[model samples]
Target: MGTTPQAGGTVAEPITLSTGETVSVPLSTEATVYGAIFSADRPAVDDLLPRGLEPIRATPRRAAVTVLAVEYHRIGDEVMTPYDEFSVMFPAVEAGERSWPFASLATHGASGYVWYLPVTTEPAKALGVDVWGYPKEVAEIDHDDHVAGRRTTVTADGQEVITLDVEAPPAVDQRQEGVSYTVKDGTLLREQLTLDGRLGAWPYSGQATWELGDHPRADRLRDLDLGERALARLRFDGEFVIGAGEPVGTV
Candidate 1:
């Protein structure tokens, strides 16, 4: 069997998925990301997590809510169509553990529970749900970049779900690793992601703006009681690699 070479000088063996599609392991992508981190009510955040997880409070009463829009320019070494994706995640930890505040954002061992994930392509949505157990749906995700900044909008069923506007800031070279927790068939799935790129971060200061529409998904986020302004806004342009997810425990 021929081996497929990947980034980092490693070779990935091809495997056929349950969907009858064949792809290389450890998916890689080149994307431009726009993100905003908001502070939400801790109890409200916890209400949305699975049984085995608890919200990671950024403060005694506040939890972190993250919204990200990724514009994928390439996937793996094969020629594929580009797609846009938007996600909502909450910083969380396994139950029965001491929850760390803001430190959870940068520290290892913490996981982000994906609450809503929408992609523009069927293949992307199918792969995410079938492999990683990500809560993915096919939606209209539009990513627009301009000389000034970027704007991303997500719509479903002819109704707008959410829209985020981010201002461009100067970036610095950085690398980050993150873990994500998802649920499939009542089992908790853990996936690791590594990113290498130039990161641009800005403190809230009323610089970032987001609006929720009448869609039910938007209403769910509205119920979270997120802070009036974002805690931080970020932009990253670089390489992203997602490892296969494995079952960690029952959800």
Candidate 2:
């Protein structure tokens, strides 16, 4: 059994799932990702967060929303059939914390609240929810590569949810560390994340487009008043590590 390290200078024991499967701590994966950050109405974003959390404003009156799709190729040291995922996230900080806006992203000072997560496999959904309280549902996620870039589509319950198209560009090596927040059983949880990869980004020059569908799940996002175009688009290819979640406070 591999021992995993926690953020608070302790080692985490493997978790035994309800399905009788054991998951090691500090989950690691190799994946290809495409993501974007969009501007949204601050008040609307605030309404979506749980208590004790506030939106990190990208601009006065405008918060930020992140949408990303990932294709996981391996887990731990084992290579497995790939699984796809699509996620919607809100950049936020704890209530009463100073908001640094754009600087927060560069410095990893803000926590990401996952609003929605759809995955292609049952294990992915189960592990996400059971381990970290990630709000995950099994869905159909399709990825296609074209000359211009890549297109990802998410469908759930026979209805389309969202589609994202991103252009490929030159990437530079980068490493990032951040925290993510989730709520489970009335408790707020925090997980540490680390990523090393080649990252490509483009400012809002029409390099990407995100479209929401008529699905009810999509309506939840529509309420945010997401901008017509993303503030920036990103692509990353490399490895990611997720630490065990620790409860921070009651929700």
Candidate 3:
């Protein structure tokens, strides 16, 4: 593993494993999360994946575009400073059933294939990509909580990639669970993430928009022809946990 140098004083207090190996994780935390999950479907672009790894679709022409802004209030076992993270992912399954994406709208169904994940901290970026194969990169991500809602932007090398605007009204108490997939060492990894908190259904009320910028990453999404109306909008304010991921197969 490469050395993940923590930005001065931002290093959380060390956590020792059973074998005396210290792990990087929070003991507990409170973070505000806001995002949207739109849809995209271009036959030419959608057909790019292998049949075995079928993309999860809303309709024949609609694939999920998920954008997020997560603010870790104080990650250090409460010792390190705080940082915000932004990510863009396509909710995909292993290419099997049509009932999967709907499960997220109803219950915990299938997971997603995260194509791009970017974080504000350099150490987290290194760990996310080098350790977990999470297609991670270091970028400038910011989140501002306003009376209307949360505004988020992700930029790389000073170029804005995408921006999201979602009006957050009073949240409705909710509990949510979902799975995500990633590959490492030729093995399929499934990560189940859960959030037990409050939600504001901004998309249902027509209060959201996704603006893809001119950056390459943004252009990648543009190729998919994401719809103007998000198929799903995720506005969560509560406890978020990425469960211990286990290897599912050597695909």
How much is the lDDT of residue 247 in candidate 2? 83
Model 2 residue runs over 4 Å out of place are 1-12, 79-81, 105-111
In candidate 1, where is summed lDDT lowest over 10 consecutive residues?
Answer: 102-111
- Residue-level lDDT for 234 in candidate 2: 80
Candidate 3 Cα misplacement greater than 4 A, ranges = 1-29, 42-52, 98-111, 202-205
Candidate 1 lDDT over 122-181, as tens digits, reads 777767887778999999988787776888999999999999988877799898888788
lDDT rank order: 2, 1, 3
Considering only N, C-alpha and C atoms within 3 Å, which residue pairs clash in candidate 1?
Answer: none
lDDT of 2 by residue, 123-219 (tens): 7777788888999999999999899788999999999999999887678999877889999888888888877888777766477888888889989
Candidate 3 lDDT, 51-81, residue by residue in tens: 3455655655566667777787754345345
Residue 19 of model 3, lDDT score? 28
Q: Judge candidate 1 at residue 44 and give its lDDT.
A: 86
Full-model lDDT for every candidate: 0.81, 0.81, 0.63
- Model 1 lDDT on a 0 to 1 scale: 0.81
Q: Which pairs clash inside model 3?
A: 111-179
